[model samples]
Each structure stands twice: as structure tokens, then as C-alpha cells.
Target: MSTYTPGESFAHRLDPRSKLAVQAGFAVAALAHTTVPGLAVLTGVCAAILLAARTHPARALADLRLLLPFLVLLPVVEGATLGPPWFSVADARAPALASYRTLLVVLVSVAYVRTTPVRESRAAVQRLVPGKPGRVLGTGVALVFRNLAVFRGDLRRAREASAARLGDERPLVDRMRLVATAGLARALGRTETLSLAMRARCLSWNPTLPPLALARVDVPVLALACTLFTWGLL
Candidate 1:
């Protein structure tokens, strides 16, 4: 739940488009360079980006805790064998690297989300793209950003209520099903409410958005993004 926090940090001052570019470029670079040494470098870059956003690495990881199980499971499953030589470190290496790469990309994205406001992100998208399609994409981004935290909160409350009802005594599968069903129901209810609220507020495709502009400080960041993209391509 690393939603935007009001701050005067360096990243906060950056144009949303530049921040988006950095995310895109970092993702490309991460995908292109998944080796040990390359990942090490990218790790440093990721840390630097987090620092620039005034975000702690531990906090970012904590925000991503929900996905950690899958990240851990992938390599383990890939390395496991049905026969003789059992688990192969060789078989696991590539997937392990790939997972770590994914982690880096996600961390970068988290940094972006933490620093950039949902409206600014929507404005950036609408500006970059045009017509009804841009508005559609922008609306989708805004809804995802705004609702993600609410959805997480719903799931948390459902889990807590389940635990209070002695859900811990239930089978693991049953507990998961209960939580998932509760969360889904809550989410659907919220969606309907949100739709009504939007209609009441006269939600428009061309709502006035905050102005976005690249400052002198943004030049270096854009340059860094370009450099990362070029490095990835190379």
C-alpha cells in the first residue's frame, strides 16, 4: 500500500512523464540484463531511485510482501525434479535471476507510485496519448491507483474478521477461499458504489488536470532514462 505521500523530495518535483520514462527504461534495462553482475548494477540503480524518492528499501519490500510468495515459489518449483538428482541449482539459477529481475522492476514501479499522484499520472497519460482512447486508459490508471489501496484494506479486514471467527482452525484451502470470496464481494460492492459516485459527480473525460511541466532538474532524469534505454538495447 505505497500510495502517494505528500513530500518535497527530488522525485516529487520530477515531471510525471520523466518518472514514467524512468520506469519504462529501468524495466527494459532490467529485462535485458539479468545476469549476476548486471543485476548487481541494476540493484544499485534501483536503490538509488528509491533513495531519490525518499523511500526505504525495507518499506518498498514490505509493500510488496503479498507477491513475495510467488516470487519465491517460481524458482523452487522450477528447480524441483521428479527423479534421481532431485533439485538442480543449474535449473534454478535462470529462474532465480528472472525473479530478482522482476523484483527490481517492481521496486522501481513502487517508487514511481509512491512519488506520483494518481491525477498527475492520469494527466500524463492523457497528454501523451490522445482522443477517447487516451481518456479511457487514463481513467483506468486512475481507478487502479485509487482503488488498489481500498481493495487491500478490504482484504485485510476480511482476513482479520476470519481470524476472529477462528478461521485459523480451518484447512488452509478453506481459509484462502473464505478470504478470497470475502474480498471479492467487498470489491464488487465498492465498484458499484464507485460507479454511482462517479455519475453523481459528473465524471468527465476532459476534467481539468493539474499542469505538468519538465523543469531544468528533469533534464538529467530524462537523460538517465534515455541512457538506461540505450544500455538495455545495446
Candidate 2:
């Protein structure tokens, strides 16, 4: 998802720090739950977040479509693996539990990723690093995340271009050569241009923070996030 400025909502207005805590706390709660009650509580938490946030549930859920397959398969595969052996196929239960645990973790991460802007998320990380090193690292993270869509688009275009040449039926090596070369060359040229632009702007070094002032909005935003995180523990 593009990390544009989110719609103005209570969630969007939160300080980067509170938002970060909420995201982290949500993840911890996701991993801590396995029973029906645990899953219900976690699901309720996500539902409430979806309701209160600036994010459109449809779009955020669409971003999560990537997880659909695993959610479907985990229970099925696990049950299958454990069902045999004359009424007790004990083998599959472990994998099932493991898969479910992983799925919960992934779902929680998707929520965080969809809600938080890449720039804001990275800036929240800056407190630990400080100075030029922190800024550069943060900006680099933002830049990489910003490019995900462009690179994915380029991959699709490359495949389409090869298919146009009837190259899809070609030998695996030949087809891969076309796709990889096309995609990598595009990424390389873009990186070169980006490097030159950064040098021209003297952004070769770390970026400086803008002079904007933090507003009163940040206070309660942080307060509630801390409260919610503590609530999750209880």
C-alpha cells in the first residue's frame, strides 16, 4: 500500500510513538492467544481498530488478501496430518499449532504495515539511533518501502513484455534471463538516478528533521496507546 498521508482521524492523529506502541502491542497480543477466547479477544481488538482508524476496512482487508491461503490451509493441512494412525495421528497437531501461531503473527503485522506510513514508522525508530546515522537509516527504510510498488509493477511489465514475444514457452533459462535482466536493469538505472539526485541535494549525508512543532494532539494519543498496551497485558 502507498504510504500517503492518512485521512484525518483520531488514529491518524496519534504521535508516531503511540502508534508504534499500539502496533507492537497488537502483535504481542496476537502471538499470545490460541484458545477461542484469545482469538475472539484479538479479533475484537482488530475490529475495534478498523472501526476507529482512518483506514478503510475494505482496503485494509484487501491488503490482507495475501494471507487468505494460509488461513484456509493451516487447519485443513493440520487436521489431515493428524487424523490417521488408527484414530490418533498425533503427528499433525504440532504443525497445526505452529501454523496458527505464525498466521496470527502475520495478520497482526499486516495491520501495522497497512496503518502506519513508512516515513512515520521509520522516524519513530530514529529516537534510538539519533544524529545523522539515524536519519539516513530511517530515510533509507522509507525509500525502500516507497519503491515496493514500482518494483512490483516493473516485474509485471517485464513478464508481459516477454509473453508478447511468445517467450513464455521458451526454455526456463531463456525466459528467466529475459525477466530478470529486464527487471534488474530497470532497478539499477533508477537507483543511479536516485543517487545522483541525492548527491545534488547534498542528501548524500543523513537528512535533517524538519522544524515543525509537535502539537497537543500528540499527548493523549500517546497516553491512550500506553493504556491500551497495558490493557492487553491484563
Q: Tell me, by lDDT, which candidate is best.
A: 1
TM-score on alpha carbons, each prediction? 0.97, 0.71
Candidate 1: C-alpha lDDT: 0.95
- Candidate 1 residue lDDT tens string, 1-234: 789998999999999999999999998899899899999999999999999999999999999998989999999999999997899899999999999999999999999999999999999999999999999999999999999999999999999999999998999999999999999999999999999999999999999999998899899999989999998999
| Model 2 vs. true fold: TM | 0.71
Give the per-residue lDDT digits (tens) of candidate 2, residues 1-234.
434445766666656666666667766665555555776676666666655565555666576566667766765665563334433336455555556555555544555555567767676667657888887777877787788778868978999999998989999999989999999999998889888987888864444443323468767655655665676677
Global CA lDDT computed for model 2: 0.66
